[model samples]
Target: MVHVGRPRERVGITRRSLFGGVAGVGATALLAACGTSTAPSAPSAGSRSADAGGGPSRVVALSTGHLDHCLALGIVPVGLAVAVSEATDSRGIPDYIKQAFGDRYDLDSIQVVGQRMSPDLEKVAGLKPDLILSNKRADKGLTEKLTGIARTVQTNGGSEQFKADLKIVAEAFGKAADGERLLADYEGRARAWGARRGTPGTFSLVRGKGDQYLYFGTRALASIVGTDAGLTRPAAQQFDEAASRTLSLEQVGLLDADWVFYSFPGNSGDFTEAPLWKKLPAVAEGRAFRVDVDPWFLNASTVAADRVLADMQRFMST
Candidate 1:
């Protein structure tokens, strides 16, 4: 679950979820700065919303999928777990969210509870949200700990998890009707975009982590959304796993397809200097382009999916 911010073209940042720890505001600092609550922070997912009748509710989201689902549905979380992924910033609001829903809502001001992988439970306790949203990918004991403090519900994963998460969260806030509409709208938009793109072609998602590169499979967020938008993938890269495949620099040829999108851990640096990069057919044809990994790579939310589809639309139009 990753939330993505705005995209700055040509900026390279790896969106793969691999790291020792996430950087976040400490509990002590958050308490000193954001106030504390002696009471339980929130209710479990099955509980009803404490928000005003017919108005938006406050949510505490543990995963990027939860955060983006609520935000796309117009329910800004009171506090959200930030990620070290290139998709989000220090505040955890991805640049794409700012660009897509900036006028509909102001997520930038939302409080940061902790990092997604290693949330500062103390800081989340201080936020005092009425509800908490998490998913199954959390470490074994962590979800139970979250439920102890608040009403937490685990969202499922897979290609359709984005829609499923919205349904769960929308019903929590008495926005079930709206959630259905959002899903319909997404399906309609995806279908229309697919029709517009017309031609079928293979897409390759590449991640550069120093000398060894990783190729995304069917389960990666962006790849899932792209496939839904009628984009095909290289047969060799298609697999049921969500994890990526790491290959040495000499194996760059394996990532070739009709189109290839590359994301780097920070900046691509002078990657073109690598001998294998030029051998890829997409590079020679200029079909391989650099993209911001935040919104395009670890993508799992409706907002990021929209951004990805919009990008494909632009590319297809050309």
Candidate 2:
């Protein structure tokens, strides 16, 4: 079953405002918009089953969220779509995936499948993916349409769901052993991170763009980081109704916590220059950390979750 959400409203802003009044757009913004095309087109299709002996030969990754999981299990799809802007490193794709696979992975082989809110159905169809894997919440409609052209699987955005999806992808590619090992390794690392830092610290996850701020729910990176680091989440009415909730600049003061991890919309860092943002205690105290929305939060999958953990460790240690 394919699921769709309300389309995101595009807010027009002047170039000067986007770059924090800098002379040119930042590298983060350029990377974020990279390979992103508004045009829609049908994707190519082909298949290879894991148990059938050799595994899926012609694969297509519809969701960037799952790209790391696929790469960990030695499955490289013919197509991949991810928000590269939020990546910690400029490698664009996850480092482990790139190191293991090399430059043979071509961006042209991958198509821009649209952002978290809006998916380009035409582009997905044009890729003709053999097996489509994505978060159940984000790609419900696209999954259904892709199924007509190829097999499709859905995984929840949660950590447990991410592991399950990895296993399923591994089985599809006949790499169940590798998948198991990868899961074990990931769990081991998480446990180590937790053990070194015993009790977990409090954290608030927010995304800022200009004057607007969106608070991520427990299901987001804040929750993931909190859980992984053995920390507690602050009680703030738990806005579980939406994936994210918008907060005013004044309201941000209410989110007082040990650490703050935030992302910017469309890769613009203009919000950092806003006087109201600078007034936040977290910002004033140097506890505020900025993340790119695409790779950091929205593109989160099993693979990217590891990076999140690493970043959290760095942030917490400091």
Candidate 3:
């Protein structure tokens, strides 16, 4: 059996990357946007089971979140999209993904089919995956092409649906019980964090650099997970439908909140020095906490979700 090898050994930034940090993940590049599209075309349906002489179920996962779900379920996919970003190292697996589920398994053995946004179709098809899993929604156009290659399943966004997606993947492998248990563990951690956190307070998750600032709302991982840990959302980010909001750096006042978790992405080394960035009450009050973009802004698995809670827990302590 192919297993994760030493190439994935824990280390500092392994290579310079062209991609932005997790928070800087281009939706058009990584996981699809959270809200559903009104007109999503249906994908062909089918699943392969390992019967008698048949080989084991071969799964190919696209996007970091889906890959997390599959790996956390203890099912190393035959092929997975590579993660390449300033937030992580060059290894197909990022440090945060490893931190979240490293104790459970090695990540090196998983085959790197290609980059996240547009994987090498030839390599993916060559794997002959019995099940092709992707959790992106914004680019459902790829659904037809993926389905043509193999049975494909995609999940919706929002924290609850993210957990549900993990269960769906588990069920696909007849490991429903395993999936539910993992979700339960995640909830337990969230609840424990909520109990110890100072008190319920408003917070905003900010991501961006230069002129393109954005806020993740109730549907994004950090916002949803922060709420799970007893934090409330700022009025501007509490919208019901969309998961995120884009704003010009000039409109920084809209980010008002008791506290804020911010990621500077590729520019963490040089936090924006704009006047608007300096004016936020949260920033002036010592309530602004800089966060790692990988786990805090990317990877939507139960493991990553728990890491979010942990980040809040650490933030509260400091």
Comparing 1 with 3 on TM-score, the higher-scoring candidate is 1
* Position 144, candidate 3: lDDT: 72
Tens digits of per-residue lDDT, candidate 3, 1-318, equal 443222232221210111112333442432222112221211111223322234237778887777766655545577788656666666667676665445434566567878766777788788877788876563666677788888887776445478778877777766676677667655655666577555788888888744466777788888778777677887888886775678776677778898888888665434457677778888887888888776677667776775566556556555
Error of 1 at 130 (Å): 1.8
Residue 29 shift from truth in candidate 1, angstroms:
44
What tens-digit string does per-residue lDDT give for candidate 1 at 185-238?
Answer: 555666656766688788888887655567888877777767777888898788
Q: After superposition, how far is residue 31 of candidate 2 from its true place, in Å?
A: 26
Badly placed stretches (over 4 Å) of model 2 are: 1-52, 81-108, 111-129, 138-144, 157-160, 209-211, 265-270, 273-280
List residue ranges in candidate 3 displaced over 4 A. Answer: 1-56, 102-104, 136-141, 157-160, 209-211, 267-271
- Each model's lDDT comes to 0.63, 0.54, 0.64
Clashing pairs in 3: 4-109
TM-score of each: 0.77, 0.67, 0.75
* Two-way lDDT contest, 1 vs 3, winner: 3
**lDDT of candidate 2 over 1-318, digit per residue (tens):** 221111022221111112222213343443232223221111111122323465555455655656656644434465555544434343245443443234323323344566534556576666656676656766457566667767766666654356677777766666676667655655566666677677766777777645566777766644664576577666762556565777775676656677878877553466567677777777889988875454355655555565565556556666
